[model samples]
Target: MSNRLLTYNPETEGAEGGLLIMGAPTRAAQPQPSTELEELELGSAFLEATSTSELASVVNRILRHGALLAGKPIASQVVQHLGARLNRAGQSVRTLLAPPAGRSDTAPSEAMERITGAELEGLSDEDKEFETARAFVRFAMEAGRLAARAPSTQPPAAVATAAARVAARRHAPGLDFVQLVPGFRARRAIRRQSFA
Candidate 1:
């Protein structure tokens, strides 16, 4: 067996273990930080993911960290990551982003300005993807923005647009599983609303 640390998952014993990405690689174990600064830096590793594709893993990692930190630091990371994308998003995506409320992040608010000020009658599929992803980011941001959870209470990057034949279940109450990561899933998923 792999030397990677195994987090026990009781699949087929219940209906919830299915949320894990099937066949996800086991994460290599790393040393616990020796310093407070190191620990703080290591804490945000989830946000360092490079693409929108890794959204689910990044989001889930964020959630895991929330358990550790007792807050939604991951949500803020999602907003900043997605916000950067939105800032650089094509004119179409920018046009679709609805303005955020006064307390919202800048990118959402920036997108919102364009959305309300523009006619925005018709946009291409890519634009809609941007819009949808933006909305998901906004929804997930509630973890940090308000310190609360939404039904879709989650975060991550590269929210998929394709449909995949996924078997999903509710997140178990105390533990989490990481099956096929959002990046891999986004490339292969076969459904409308895929998440990790």
Candidate 2:
């Protein structure tokens, strides 16, 4: 009953009639630019996506433009859209989990510095969260700080301390799902012997 584009071909299907409403040509006919310079000219339209329709428009535009050049696919527009959404989500998570009135982005790095500078003995439950992020960031920021310090500082004790901090973090508010599985537990034995 509805009107739509139809196709008839004798070569492919022995003279069968088919409804061709939304085929590749239909998509490819959307007036996409042929060159990178033309694409660059549409910058504001690409980056100004706030809704799904707007995002899809940008993606479709890129795909169309790419199809003209070497028939390559352009999937990066979707990736860029997803990346923007994820950055906002990460910032929100950082803000909500951060200590009261503390910043979102700087909190993780700051927590790392604090634990590294402090004596590990008398920290409370909240301090344990800071210390956990600190230990993680320290191990990440400095290649072998834990390995170097653990021996002089005592291995089993440091590992146990790190393990305890990880556990405490597992119990903290707004951080129930993330568990710190020290990927370098193998290094602990070396630390134990060297420190002992």
Q: What TM-score does each of the candidates earn?
A: 0.22, 0.22
lDDT (10s digit) by residue, model 2, range 81-136: 32333223223333333556545645554443343444444655455444543332
Error of 2 at 16 (Å): 44
* Candidate 1 structure, TM-score to reference: 0.22
Q: Please list the residue runs of candidate 2 whose C-alpha ends up more than 4 Å from where it truly belongs after superposition.
A: 1-36, 71-196
- Model 1 — which ten-residue stretch has the worst lDDT? 159-168
Candidate that scores best on lDDT: 2
List model 1 lDDT by residue over 1-196, tens digit each.
Answer: 6532243445322243322222332123322323444333432332343455543454444334332332323344444543343223322332333333554545543443343333223665444434434333322232222221211233333221100111112111100121223465554542333344
- Tell me the spans in candidate 1 whose CA falls farther than 4 Å from its real position: 1-53, 61-121, 148-196
lDDT values for all models: 0.32, 0.34
Native-vs-model 2 lDDT?
A: 0.34
